[model samples]
Target chain A: MRKEVRVAGFGGQGVILAGVILAQASGAIEGREVAQTQSYGPEARGGAARCDVVISDKRILYPKVRQADLLLAMSQPALAKYAVDLDAAKGKVVIDSTLVNELPDGLPPVYRVPATKIAEEEFKNRIVANMVMLGALARVDDVVAYDSLKRAVAENVAPKFRDLNLAALDRGYQAVEGPGLRPAAGANDAPGAPASGGR
Target chain B: MSEDGRKVRIIQGNEASVEGAIAAGCRFFAGYPITPASEIAELMSRRLPPVGGTFLQMEDEIASINAVIGASWGGAKACTASSGPGISLMQEGVGYAAETETPCVVINVMRGGPATGQPTISSQQDIYQARYGGHGDYEIIALVPSSAQEAYDLTIKAFNLAEEFRVPVYLLSDEIVGHTRERVVMGGPIEVRERVAPPKEGYRPYAAGPDGLLPGMPAFNDGYRLLVEGQHHDERGIRAGDDVNKSAALVQRLNDKVRKNIDRITDVERVDLDDAEVAVVCFGSTARPALEAVQSAREKGVKAGALRLRVIWPFPEKVVAELAGRARTLIVPEMNIGKLVLEVRRSAGGRAEVISLPRLGGALHTPEEVEGAIMDAVKGGNAR
Candidate 1:
């Protein structure tokens, strides 16, 4: 299956890092062709940062993802920016519930999780909010294996924050969901069958 | 797939140039960061030190070229790289290298520019700058590589040409050739060219032979006291500006050496021109896409062909003139605002209808765009 995802937020929110992890995990673990590209202007302060990752069994023609299958928004600005362009045919919108007051309705399958509060309050670090979001993404849609993502994170995260980010990922995977939360399409009965280490 | 017993891997053009430079025995590099060209510097920094070579990120482009020249004089095959604006800052130093007869490679990954025009934008605007940007009437050897393979292959050639002729060689690349990712083969053992040593017994650094050129030069402490400078000099490298005869002789020899050896540096790739009525003349980054367009046009029975120029400086005038003689119409497309198209029109001898398709800033004209221009040329347009 083809998966094209865009992770976007403020410049320092680790959204780009999340997209890179997803691309790396998909390529190295699933053995799929992946293209990860980020676009940002010169300014470092409060600028919009977006990274697009496209995973496919076939060759990726263009590096940029025009219509994203999944839009993971970490801030209100990110949601406002990418909500219109999400492919509703196969897209899922995941938002940070704490930062977002009202979720934009009539989108693809919506999952609102308190990503920032979970990372900062439960995991005791705000920087791993993107990792928490990635964990929630793995639980919602088995697009990438959680163990494969953890290996990807361990391989890519800066040495000082590796352990904290792993903990953040675990906390996110175990979070609560409302009644009758349907798993993503094509999810396997075998636990984390898409990912490695049987997690 | 294996061709010539080598594996192909996807790599960017800038990385291909870096690998090419490494394969060409370039052991010393000094450069500053510039968009569309930074990957060359970055890869050099990573790859050079492990192989007992050196790479330095200089403070600016001037310092970068200066350091490379210093490294070249220290008996190392050295190189520096930059984009258009940075290249402009290095012209004075580049002219100094020319006057001193230093052998070094300078890679200019051309970008859109007037003054910081657009940092991320791509253009082939550095053609004039590469040939005539430096002060005076000195001839520079410039190689234009059209693809990732050429970016790797011509770099070794660039070094050999520079050392053999005692001149600075510029690898003129643009954004398309710099950033495009394609298949490149590496790890092939290259046939290296060693520099020719000067004759013993009172060797003169600037002495003109019967052919009006300086012969091979030996390094310092090689049993000869070689005096080199940026000024007009006599046989022994002493400043000879006061004497008009010596200055004229020095300048004439410098020009003749390159002018006499144009055949050694001239290279061109021709495709489907035997029965063509219209031709597309282009160089550097525009050549590949234009050639693709020409092939598509030919399949549609438009009788179009392409001439991809490999040598920008010394301007492959003979081949261009020859190709122009055969075709009824010639269209020249460039990324800059009509820099090389003018040269094509001037050199084609007005035998063919020369058309200029110029695009400014970073945007590259797609193959369909060139196809439209080819169709226009097929419609009996007047010569420019």
Candidate 2:
């Protein structure tokens, strides 16, 4: 199976790192063909940043993502910019409910996770929010094995933060189990409605 | 794999190039940092020390190229890398390396051109610059790689060719190929080329052997008296001082050393060209999309094929001419504004219809774009 994934957020959200870990999990640990590319403006931080990871069973002919099969948005601007490019009929969308308060109408199946809230409240660090999103992605999609992702996170993170990041990942994986966390009711559903009913 | 049994690893192209250089026995690196090419310098700084090699971040591109040449004469396999603007500053130094017959590698991770255009974007705009950037009539070998694996593999080939031919060789990469990450098989036993050393007894540095090529070099401070200069010199390394015949012969020999070995130096990856009616000639990152376009065209019964030029300089004229003779139409797509297509037209020699599909402004040609051009060429329509 060929899967094209895009992870987008501001520069400091560790969006590029999340993409790298995904690529490693699928390619190095799982022995699959993968290509990862990232782009950002001149600003070092606070500017929009995005990464594209293409995982395939066969040789990848084109490296860039023409239409993303999985879209992970960590900010309002990133979702507004890239959500339209997702494959509407079959694509899966994941968004951080803590930062992104709005969702477009008539979207594909969307999984909303309180990634930043879990990192900030449980781990006392908001920086591990990307790891939380990764965990949720693993739970939502069977693109890569959960064990492979755990190993990848261990290998990619620094020694000091490895334990905290892994904890964040586990919490993220469990976030999808709460009730009323499916796709929003309709296009006109209230903003921030998905996260209020869940812990 | 090496004897230690290290397997494949996913790495960026710039990192792969460094590994390739290290595998090729390159012991010295000097370069100034530039965007899209800076990763090469960063990795070299970290990796060279562990291997007991030397890495120097020179003050600028001018100093970097000169240092590379000096290290080459110091009996070390040396190289330097930069992007377009930095490469522009190193032109005089590159010319000096050519004149002195220094065996060194110069990598230009090409970007959008003319000035400091598009540092983060990729472009094939340096095709002319790689060939004619340095002044005077001289020849240099240039290799263009399409993937990160080739970026690793061809860098070793670049160094080997540089040492074997005793000339400056270029690995013409672009931002896309340098920055993209892919699976590159690491840890292989590579054949490292040894620099030819001159006989200790009465060696002349500039003397050409019976084949009219440069002889083995005597290392500096190796108890052999050697005078290296950029001026016109004779077999005994003495200044010829505007002696028209001697200077003309020296210049001719310098050019002939590479031109005579053109057949051995040229390499092209031809795909699906057995009965192609339309052919696309491309190189570097652009070849990726061209390959897909050719496959798509074949599916549509267009009989489309592709000839990817692995060696851009020394211009694979013979292969191109043969392909042109067999195919009715030739489409040349590049990331620049029709620089290499002119060479393709000249090589085609009116044997076929040569079309230039030039895409500029820091964007690559999609497979759809190339496929549309191929279809247009097959219909004998003038399409840009």
Candidate 3:
């Protein structure tokens, strides 16, 4: 099966790092094929930056996300800009609700995790918001195995931030169960969040 | 790491190149940082030093290429990396390397441009520039990697070819392939070819042996009197600008050395092309989407296939002609306006209808987009 995940936020939110961890979890730990690409050129500071991770049992043909199965929108503008291309019925969006004041209409199931709030409150650092969202993504969708993500975090993160990153991933993973994973890979209507139709 | 719990590493495309270069005994790296390609220089800075290699961040791209050439002459496997704008600046140095028969590798992590067009975006626009960038008639090996693993494998190939052929070799990649992260399996016991040293007796710096390659390149201060002149010179490395026969022979041999070995130097991947009436010809990161499109078209019962160029330069003419002979239509897709498509047209030779699907300063061709082009090619039904 092919799964494409896109993590988007402003420049300094560790969006790219989060995608790398997801890729490492799937590719390096689980031994699957993964390709990660990002919006890395001349993106202005504070602009909407994004990284795309394509995970597959077979070789990933196209590297970039064609239709994102999961969208981790850490900023309000990121959601506004990238939500249009999210898989309408099957896709899932995990947003940092503390920063996102509102949600666009007609998106797939959105799990509002308030990643920034949790990162600041529990970890004492707001920069780990991307990791929090990734953790929530694991619990909310099971795109990657939760244990592998923890392992990936341990292996990929900097020495200074490794402990905090693991804790942040665990906190997000344990707090919520991916309503989509309970049954099968196909994401269904779960009890955790409402499926938005209109504003 | 492999299924047996071997070392399966997740690395970016640029990082893979560094690992490959290190594996191939490349100990010298000189470059200037450029967007989308800076990571290569950054990683090389950390990578080369630990391997007992040297890393030099020169003042500019020209100095970077020149330094690489100098290092190569100093008897170290050397390379440099840059994007389009910076690579354009290295044209004179590249020519000098070609003229001097310097063995070095230059990685062009291509971006959009005639100038510094799109430092943040990706393009295959430099395809022609790499082959014919300098002022003289010369040929250089250009390998275009479609994935991160290929990036690693081809980089080692680039260094090996540079040393064996005594010509500057290029790994023509784009920002997408350069910056994308993927799994690269490190192979066991990488084979490396070092430049052959000459015998003590009767060694001329610019003279070709019976094998059509220079006898040998002596390291600087290696007990050999080497002039290292870039001007048209005789076998003794002395300027022979006034000697027509010597100048002609020297230049011809430089081009002939690579041309004669084209069969051994070229590599390509063919997918579902057997008995297909329509085929998509592509390279670099664009190849993946084109393959998907061709596969999807086959599901819909269209006789379509894909050909991906692993080695870009040497043109791979025989394969293109063979594909053109069977397939009635050839679709050439590139991230540039029209570079590889032009070569495809030339090689197709009106045997098949050649179509160019060009994109610029932007994203890769989506499978859907390439599928649409394939469908159109099939519908057009232009026969040979």
Candidate 4:
């Protein structure tokens, strides 16, 4: 089974960076085969940026994710744009409670987290919202160990921002790692274990 | 044979290529996916992470090649793979690596194209592009693998050739070879081709010595102030030529390293061509049919042989010229209208009658067609 996820939001919302951190954790740290692709043109401003990450043991046939198992939409536009591609029966959707005003109809089990509110109220850094989103993705997918994801964030972020990123990740983890959250079906599995290495 | 390692298995051409890159000690990959070549990016994305390496799918083909360049300097063996349209976008990056003498591998899985011609159809139209698409007067090593097994073996060779010469190597394949389903013998850990990392001190990124070619480059963050770009530059990698003589000399030297070392880079599998009166020259998938054609001709006492060009670039002029001396006729069969045939014509030196047998699209030339061409060439009177 492959864990295919997409993180989408405005350029500065750290969607691409969030995807990178998860990819590194699942792919590099966990020793799974991982493919991460991002979409961006010359307009690096407020344009929408989407990153696709596919983690599988067998060789991934296509890097472009046609159907996403997990979708993290940090804004309304992201939710509206990618909601149709989500497999409602088998997928999971996480939205930022602050930016997303209403959940789309016929969506997967939507988990709402006040990512921006947490980043503003506690972390005091807007960029840290991605960290919260990452934590939420971990809670929803459990594709990689929460500790492994934290380690990936610590190793990937610039030295100056590493401390805040790790703190934000832990805070996000603490918020959703409890009993009320939906259990991940393929949870606690190593990323790209040998048995699943090649297709 | 298996203990000697690098055996084969039943694998797709793209998977074979990924395994081959790893066997060649390629630890970094940065690429964007396009059809017919997406499997390469997919495989690298997963494989690089486990070995403490990095796999990045950049924003586009341009960024993909650029990031590969960045990672190469970051002291990682780097590579990228793409189909026709994406490769067209990567020409600038290819020129950049050639100018900087940055060692990396770029795999171009050829598909029918002038502009998005056919993403999934096989064609060898990129032969000239592989040699001339990059912007400057530079030479590159391009290897063409005919089968999945060769795809695996040649990717390793591509990395070795790239590092040994300090230039970008091209594992040039068509959609047929890229997506072909064949039993690839993939066995024990093969001997990987590792780059000769530069010394700690006295490392100039482009210090071409009396031999007049750049040396093995040092990595970035390695204390060496490495200067790199896509300009006609001196040994210091600083843009040094606005005049004809300097630019001409630089181009000559860049061309010389591989042009001079053809025996090493030009891997031609000559099957019974030693004393044949007719020669069939081909590369990639076409060569398989061409080989059968040659065998059938010999059975009919036509004295025909086949030369499969495993390495497409560097042209193998000397070998072709030598083989031309012994053969009375050289039949050049390729998938494209006529690309590599021109190279063969020039190298055959008018000693042998050079004939071109062309095809296009997903229509593969059958062994009977190639046999007919060989027979027709043999029957013709232009035996110079």
Which candidate do you rate higher for DockQ, 1 or 4? Answer: 1
Q: Is the docking of candidate 2 incorrect, acceptable, medium or high quality?
A: medium
Tell the DockQ for candidate 1: 0.11
lDDT of 1 by residue, A1-199 (tens): 6677889888888887888788768876666777665655445657888877878786543344668888888889889878888987677877877776666666777777788999888877788898888987787676788888999889889888899988787666655232234443343323322332111
For each candidate in the order shown, give its overall lDDT on alpha carbons: 0.79, 0.87, 0.87, 0.80
lDDT tens readout by residue for model 3, B4-104? 44355889889889988988889999999998789899999998887899999999999999999999989999999999889989999999999999999
Evaluate residue B228 in candidate 2 and report its C-alpha lDDT on the 0 to 100 scale.
86
Best by lDDT: 2
Give the docking tier of candidate 3. Answer: medium
Candidate ordering by DockQ (highest first) = 3, 2, 1, 4
Query: What would the per-residue lDDT of candidate 4 be over residues B1-384, giving only the tens digit for each residue?
Result: 356564534345788899888877889998899878999999998988898878888899999899888888888889999988999999999888887777899999988878988775778899899899987688999999987778998998898888788889999987767765444666575656565666757666677766555556677776777777566776666777786776777788888887887787778999888778889998997887788788888899888898889998989999999998989889888888887889999999898889999897745677888899888887785542
The regions of model 3 sitting more than 4 angstroms off are A41-44, A174-199, B1-6, B382-384
Q: Give the TM-score of candidate 3.
A: 0.94
Best by DockQ: 3
Candidate 4 structure quality by residue, lDDT tens digits, A57-151: 86443344668988889889999999999977778887888898877789877767788889999988888999998887777566777888988
Reference-based TM-score of each model: 0.75, 0.93, 0.94, 0.64
Q: DockQ, per-model, please?
A: 0.11, 0.60, 0.73, 0.02
lDDT of 2 by residue, B199-225 (tens): 878778888876667767668888878
> How large is the i-RMS for each model, in angstroms?
5.6, 1.1, 1.3, 12.9
* Arranged by TM-score, best first: 3, 2, 1, 4
